[model samples]
Target: MNEIELTIEQSKIYNGVICPYCKGISEMIKSKEIYGKDYGWLYICKPCDAYVGCHKNSKRPLGRLANKNLRKLKNEAHRYFDKIWKLKILDRTKAYNWLSEQLNIPFDYTHIGMFSEKTCRTVVEISKRALNDNRRLDMDFGVEPVTEFFETI
Candidate 1:
């Protein structure tokens, strides 16, 4: 990533977050609390069964805690969205820029981890549409990601 891209990603570092589902405070606990095995830390809301993973080796939450349904949507969103850059349709940064433009969201707010269900659906829709139109996208941009996105998220 360039200095500017690095700066943008670093700017939104999430230290802690209120649970979006229940409006409760999330607790930072070992991943085993929910995963049945230790992987890393997770910020979670017990009553609502909502949770979000943290960045590796950090106490900061990745994003807002998600309920089960929203988590599924996030996975689907990633599946489609990742392909755009993975297949070299556009360079990772440009792929995100394209998504940002298409979604009319700012580039800094474009990560799928922070998206709501509605936005996740839109991401899937647009990503699928873009992937289907990959040849044109490849011809149009002919670029793809400098670094891998977070897999645990």
Candidate 2:
């Protein structure tokens, strides 16, 4: 078998997380440098304008650095997926676990924050399918309607 070649971004030996745009190791900087207020720390690629926020007050990045388009996709994925738990269809942890199975990714790496654009799109498609399935079940069984269920919760 041939050996698989890893790109710079895919390699684990880099000193810091790679920027999706520039494919360079990112620099840790204050969020205020980009946001005008110190939201927290971030791993940033200044030339590419790609960045990822750190975990709360730490230097640890929440996920890979994303550009504007990736950021949009990530937000959209979260918007749809969050509803599964928000509507009590599944608890937050179970919802993530379900997403992990749907995406065929390991549970530990299933976070939307860490997903690429393709994965984010998959998340949106999976969530829409799940919501539709729930609606169909509700209708067929004459159980609580989807709209009413949301209103009551």
Candidate 3:
């Protein structure tokens, strides 16, 4: 495990955040509450918690997708969203192709004869994660985090 220590000076100096869990630079996150709260804000782990405010770091690397690859995936997702706005079952072909290109994970899309349903579900979840990551990228690029957008969603 990487020894992640909070730089108190840095934390105090800036109004930003450091994760209480791993002490990594915390990224602001939003969560949808079911009861009365409905939605709220929090700081979270950048690498692991794509959007759900999950802090536990996974072995998986963040944005392992190249900037170019991520852009392509994001654009394709927008197109997919245009075709079908439902968040549940996104198109498998687009999702797999983009993920394969982004992660450089060699996969035979056509040869995926057996686990089609499982693959579609997995890709849908990954697509949501990728979309969340895209928002973070927008933030990094100086696009404002629209709190209203989070509240309404």
| CA-lDDT, candidates in order | 0.74, 0.77, 0.39
lDDT of 3 at 128: 53
lDDT by residue for model 1 (106-130), tens: 7777778778899998888877766
TM-score winner between candidates 1 and 2: 2
Task: Give me the displacement of residue 119 in model 2, in angstroms.
Answer: 0.9
Better of 1 and 3 by lDDT: 1
lDDT of 2 by residue, 1-153 (tens): 124455665643222377766677788888999899998998888898788887787877777788889889999898888988998889999998898888887777677778889999888887877887887788999887553322111
Residue runs of model 2 more than 4 Å from their true location after superposition: 1-16, 141-153
Query: Can you rank all candidates by lDDT, best first?
Result: 2, 1, 3
Tens digits of per-residue lDDT, candidate 3, 39-118, equal 45543455644222222443222221112233344444444332322333336576556656544445442222112234
Q: What pairs collide in candidate 2? A: none
Q: What is the lDDT of candidate 2?
A: 0.77
Model 3, stretches more than 4 Å misplaced?
A: 1-97, 101-115, 144-153
- The C-alpha TM-scores of every prediction are 0.77, 0.80, 0.27
